[model samples]
Target chain A: MSKSIFYHAGCPVCISAEHDIVSLIGAENVEIVHLGDNPGSIEKAEKSGVKSVPALVTPQGNVLHINFGASMEDLK
Target chain B: MSKSIFYHAGCPVCISAEHDIVSLIGAENVEIVHLGDNPGSIEKAEKSGVKSVPALVTPQGNVLHINFGASMEDLK
Candidate 1:
């Protein structure tokens, strides 16, 4: 039930983001719910209000998602 | 047996590529293998020498992969 669940669809960005989060929270602190592999988890994520991939469900039950855009250099 | 198989891990690029390929060949002609979703298919993909996502396996057993780099304009 650690699922401080990180829901990912396995994009490179998602992969990297998961790595960073795990490093911060410690691997044992989180559960990775892959939306692609775990269809059952999809409903759980949706219940948490996840409408996209790379979602993180905090232990407190809030859903956090991301949108990758141009790199900093591109912002100029 | 339509698996002109397309192996993807659900990145935006992979998603777009899959869409384009299906448009070209027709959905009925291909089998979409999501590596994250189908753990069972990973073995098949590896046997076919798939080293990355967004891979396409032709009906004849040919594997095609890509490495996305800077856009063409970036070369200037």
Candidate 2:
């Protein structure tokens, strides 16, 4: 199974934390979509019910993450 | 003073309705920032306390709007 992570590069927290998540999850296992650079990204985000940034979308089309300026521990 | 509007171009509603708002307010009166294309956009959004897309930012750095799939009339 593959996982996709959608995030806006404009968010400092998202940018910083995404790196860590990618490191932990292994970059090969995840697809990173920078919403800021892609016009169609939000459509995917909305379809997956994403209301916030640094969100994770699974290959099954489920949105499973949100970043609210919380720490890494809180993220888990 | 100029007013700024921050929105993600990836959002269908934001893209569609921004045109109207621009027409209503006059393009010269507003600054449209496509957060999806700008890396620093969300920082400005966070400073304005925006938690959603299609949000409007005023010259005074106030976030004044949110689009929740409402119609034009309902939006006003």
Candidate 3:
């Protein structure tokens, strides 16, 4: 199963967490979508009930993970 | 005088606004600093009294502009 991570490039926390995630999971395993690149991301986020960036969606599409400023250890 | 814009990559609003600013001022005229790139950004933001991302600082260092989800028109 693949994991997709949707994030905003302009948010500090999101960017920081993304790097940590990449470090932990390796960039190859994670598919990153930069919200700023897509204007429709807001609507997608709303549909997915996303209130913040750095949201993680599992390949099965059954789990949605929201991080409210996670530590490096948590990310790892 | 140069203009420096500081922003976070994780926040949706910041990413949205940063794009607007880029579209408005042109990428060359704007010096964008992604806060996630620098761990010291938090301290810099605190010292500059920044409560949010997409903060713009003028060359003279007299004016600090903070964008709270501005429209394209406002950005232009």
- Best-performing candidate as measured by lDDT: 1
lDDT of 3 by residue, A5-71 (tens): 5445446766765665454335876677666666556566556555555555444442233334332
Give the lDDT ranking, best first.
1, 2, 3
Tens-digit lDDT track for model 3 on B14-71? 6755564454345776677666666556566556655445565444342233334332
lDDT of 3: 0.50
- Residue runs of model 1 more than 4 Å from their true location after superposition: A1-76, B67-76
**Between which residue pairs do clashes occur in model 2?**
A36-B36
Per-candidate interface DockQ score: 0.02, 0.02, 0.02
- For model 3 the TM-score comes to 0.38
| lDDT string, candidate 1, B1-76, tens digits | 4347878777776786667556544688778977767667777787896766676677666554532322222222
Q: Which window of ten consecutive residues has the lowest lDDT sum in model 2 chain B?
A: B67-76
lDDT of the structure predicted as candidate 2: 0.55
Q: Which stretches of model 3 miss by more than 4 angstroms?
A: A62-76, B1-76
In candidate 1, the residue pairs with backbone N, CA or C atoms under 3 Å apart (3 or more residues apart, or in different chains) clash, namely: none
